[model samples]
Target: MAQTVGDFLVERLYAWGVRKIFGYPGDGINDVFGALNRAGGKIEFIQARHEEMAAFMASAYAKFTGELGVCIATSGPGASHLVTGLYDARLDHMPVLAIAGQQARTALGGHYQQEVDLPSLFKDVAGAFVQQASAPAQVRHLVDRAVRIALGERRVTAIILPNDLQEEPYHEPGRKHGTLHSGIGYSRPKTVPYDADLHRAAEILNSGRKVAMLVGAGSLGATDAVIAVADKLGAGIAKALLGKAAVPDDLPYVTGSIGLLGTEPSYTMMMECDTLLMVGSGFPYSEFLPKEGQARGVQIDLAPDMLSLRYPMEANLVGDAAETLRALLPLIEQKTEKSWRADIEKNVADWWKTLEERAIQPAVPVNPQRVTWELSPRLPDGVILTSDSGSCANWYARDLRIRRGMMASLSGGLASMGAAVPYAIAAKFAHPDRPVIALVGDGAMQMNNMAELITVAKYWRQWPDKRWIVCVFNNEDLNQVTWEQRVMEGDPKFDASQQIPNVPYHRFAELIGLKGIYVDRPQAVGPAWEDALAADRPVVLEVKTDPEVPPLPPHITFQQAMNFSRTLIKGDPREGGVIRETARQVLGAILPGGRGD
Candidate 1:
């Protein structure tokens, strides 16, 4: 039997080092699915419950592994469903290639079923490369370029395969006009600024007394370089949410996370700094950064477009984070001043204490912050952590203690809900030997994550380490938006849209062959985590948490305080709980042995 175009596409993907693909199947993509089957596991296809989740898994896989992530789907809705997840990859700068099947070629432009205009639909998300294979010869280069471009640019790409054409016999591009052959393989190059630019960057950084540094996802591999730079400049390092794992929280000078879901120390540091060094971070929201011209800034990034985007920099060095920092280190003068360093460390210490005080303060059933606080010290070595967007992210950002060798990520740029469980599944699959965990909110769980538990059930036994866990913060509300509406919009929580049905999430887990641990008491949070860690199989640890506990920003504005006051005056549905919890949060930091809302 001769090979078909589908076989050639699969073979070429395998050659480009694609080992796993996350996607849902359909009749439109049956030919390629057949090809995947015939290949006999050279590349494994992990079926997700939905195409969106599959795409999220692919994005997370790229994030965790630093390799190209691949996802596939059928036509029309299948292809369109991938847009949101693909945008997650695009915005976060993850390398991902989406493969989708189109309607039969003969039906093109005739409005056939599932014959959506895939190119137009994917043009934005997969803007780097989006092509459909019309001939067998065209399939090879399309596969090669799609994979190469996605990896090279750290962006999303796509390949559309028509079902009928995929069944045609493979053919090499004939030696004629308009026919060309393309090859596989791409090795990332060392990118560093020239000696002059590196020196200029060092000069700007070295000239400052109270220096501050902000790191993001781009700084993940440059931890050592970041530390050296921070130490030499006597700078306090503040991690953007994506850079949570870039530097361990154990570092005294490290001021946890920065931004809306940020720490007070980070806000203080940015406000007070005379100079700033931003490395490989596209942390939006310039208000959180040093005011324009208040601090002299120097930035280093691989993409020139992203350089100095958040803040104007005196020297914008275009290069990889580790390489550029390594090159600039020799010229960077070490600051002997201990006062500035001491101030940052002191603030960081105080902030952690405040968080502890806040966490210990009780709520209706359990404090949300307490869940992560207890889990922090218990996090095992080499564990991979993921969090969904919402109130849970606030706790994940502020409370979780990420030690060295631990990896953590979320839907950073997209900040999309319903991604944590899928991200955890991808993390577990990428490194089956390592423990994986996800922090999720009830809204996201009901939206999509509950279905993904089945995906875990299907594949958990295959993983070497069965310590996979998804901890659900069962707050029966769209907690983040509720707070945003209250504080940002000066509106009370609208129960009609914000309320969610209470779910027996742990019971659902137990029914699916996974271990289930339910905790309603604050004290039980720690022990429940302990039980999950020691479980023989995957686990779903659900905690009934208080929704009224606000996810306050690092530096609350006067307007936000007023908004909260107005929200209460307007009579929020949960007015009593809101006032009680908010008071407890505010007073907990000041009062001795303060506990309970």
Candidate 2:
């Protein structure tokens, strides 16, 4: 049989090492789906309930595995639904290839069913490479180029397949067929800094009395190099949220995370340091970093544009993190002073104690921090964890420590809510041998495609050795947004649009044939997690938590404090409880004692 355009494209994808494609089917792209079917087990099609979830899964797949992720959708709404997830991939610098089917060529510019300009739709997110296969011969080359660009740039690339073109045969009188099969290979280029630049960076580091390192996801492969640089300079390390797994948090001078969801120790360390060394991270929050002119900075990054994007730098070395650090280490002068390192270590230790005290504080409904605190120690080695955006993320950022061999991430740049469930689903797909867990708030789970739980139930039996746990914080509030509203606008307790109708997520999971565990009290948090972990199938452990508890920033501004006071003065019903909780948090920070009532 002569090869069709769809078959040729699928053949190229298979050759490029694409094992799975996540998406939904529609009439516009039925021919591509047919090609996928013919490919058989060469490529598995993961059918998601929504195109958005498919995009999220693909983004997470790339994030967790460091491979090119692929997702497909039909015309119009199907293609449009993928915008948000594509943005998530683009912003997070994950390599993803999105394929969308277009209306038949005959209907171009005509008002046809499900007809939308796909190239214009995806221009912003998939702007790196967006092209349509208008002719049969273009299919193979476009697919090859899209894959290469996505892999090479670590950005999203898109290909639009019109229905008519997908069915056309790829044959010409004298032209050789199957050229795509012979010429499909992708290799990432290694980048390193010049000797002079490395020396300049080292000189800046040696001139400062106190040094600090800020690592981001770009430092994932350069963990040893990062630690070596820090140890040589007696520097404290603060990881950006995306770089949480770059190094283990148990290291003496490693401050957990820095940003709005940062730890107090990390904020303190950044403020006190005279020199800052940034590695593989473009952390956007500049307020959390040292003020300009306060610290001399040196940054090392593979992308030239990101070298000094966040903080001003005296020396910017454009190179791979591991290679750059390896060269810079020899030029750095070791610091003998232990006082700076010791001070930061003491602060980190005290901060952990404060978190522990807050986690176990007695309340009518359970404190959400306790969920992460108890879950932290119980996590098995090499587990993959994901958290949703909201109050749940704050707790996960502050409470959960990423130990050696473990991996964690979220919708960091996009800060989308419904990401945790899809991210967990993708992580499980990528690493079936490792345990997968998702920490999501009640608001985020229901806002998007909670039906994705059904996808989990569908695929649970396929990977019997793996366990998937979804820990839901059921506070019946869009708690993060509620707090933001109060703090930013000084508003009284108004539930008009801030509250979510409480749903029994555990029962919902049970109805879908997954194990369910519900905990309404603090005492049940640990056992419920244990039970869910031991369950043979997928499980949803829903813990009811207090909505009144705010996820206060590490350093509260004077305006934020005034906002809280105004809210209390404006006759908020929870005024007394809020004051007591605030007092407990303040006491936890200042006192040397462990748990406080």
Candidate 3:
């Protein structure tokens, strides 16, 4: 019997190491889905509530597995909705393949039920795009090309399949697309090291009295080089939010993160440093930049384009970070005294002490930041923590620690919501032995496919520890959105009060066959958390939280502080006084009780 096109695509995907594919079925792609199901346990079909979630999950999977993660959508709105996740995959350099259904070949260009130009719609988001040209042979070639582009290029791939194409008879055997190759030919430019330039940079480091090293996401693979540079230069190391995992926080040279929402040590280091070394990071927040115009700085990156893009550079090294650092190692003269290093370490230690105290102080309607901090200490080493954008983003950015050997990934620049579940699913699938957990706000989780609980449950049936754990800090409202609203409109009344009602998220999980635990009491959080972790299956730990509590990122803008103050002072002192007092309790402990300008 001749194999069908549908059967061939499934075989190709299975060969590509895809254990599961997530999507919503439509009549146009029904034959393909049927073929996948008939493949019988080789490739599992995961049904998501929305195509967007499927895309997000697939993108996360690709990131975790370092292979092409595939998501299927049934054309039109389904394909359109996938744009968000595809954009994320592109920005983060994830490998994802979007297999979308199209109108029948005969109805091409006509406004059938779900017809749209796949190539045009996906132009910006996808690294490669193709349409199955109504021929089985073409479909076979395009699928192979897509897999190559997605995996090798490390970008999103979009393939549009018409109804007729999926049903077409196939003669040739399907072959898996080879991995896509990206950035291979772009050799690091050679650096003609000027002895004078090195001498000048070294002089700045020696003469500045105090210097700090700021690293960013682009420096991820060059840790040893960064540490050597920092040590040789007697520089304290600080990271942008995206670069937090580059160096272990416990290092004496480490001073935590810097940004609009940064920790105290980073803020202090950023302001106090007489000289700065910008390493492979494009930190977007210029507000956190040093005020001194004449402050000497050196920027080093493999990509020449990224250097000096954020700030002026005194010296630029356009080479791989490790190679550059190796070159500079011998040139750098070691410092004699440890006074500056000791001072920076002391400052960081003091700041952490204060933060720890603030995190533990008792209060009703628990502080979200405090809860997140406490939770972080309890997480097992190497646990993959995926955070959604919103207030939770602030918490995860500031508090979450990526222990050594742990893989931490987030939508740093293109930060978006609804990535938590997908990230956890992907993490679990990639590292079946490691624990994978997602921390999401109620609002962000709802936008993506929270229904992915089905996929997690299925995986859990195979392996229990790999069971995805979703810990939702459900505030019954979009607190992050409301906070932004308050900042923009200066009106607390303009909140997500209408969008969120008390939904029994835990009960909803139970109905789907996973363990569901709801924690309204702060005291119940620990036990519930432990139980959820020990559960033999996928679990949802829905934590009811205070919507009004803001994540304190230490370096909040002055305007934001004023708005917060106004919100507190304008309301009745009795109820609102509690919030004001809470704010004072946290912020007052820091410098001046004022905000970053």
Please report the candidate that would top TM-score against the real structure.
Answer: 1
Model 3 per-residue lDDT tens digits across residues 108-141: 8777777888778888888466555567766666
Score residue 253 of candidate 1 by CA lDDT: 93
TM-score of each: 0.98, 0.96, 0.84
Tell me the tens digit of each residue's lDDT in model 1 across 388-410.
99999999999998899999999
Residue 439 CA displacement from its true place in model 3, Å: 1.1
For candidate 2, list the clashing residue pairs, or say none. none
Ranking by TM-score: 1, 2, 3
Candidate 3: worst 10 consecutive residues by lDDT?
Answer: 179-188
- RMSD per model, one decimal: 2.4, 2.8, 4.9
Error of 2 at 30 (Å): 0.4
Q: Write the per-residue lDDT of candidate 2 for residues 66-91, one digit (tens) a residue.
A: 99999999999999999999999999
Compared to the true structure, candidate 1 yields what TM-score? 0.98
- Per-candidate clashes, comma-separated: 1, 0, 4
Q: Give candidate 3's TM-score.
A: 0.84
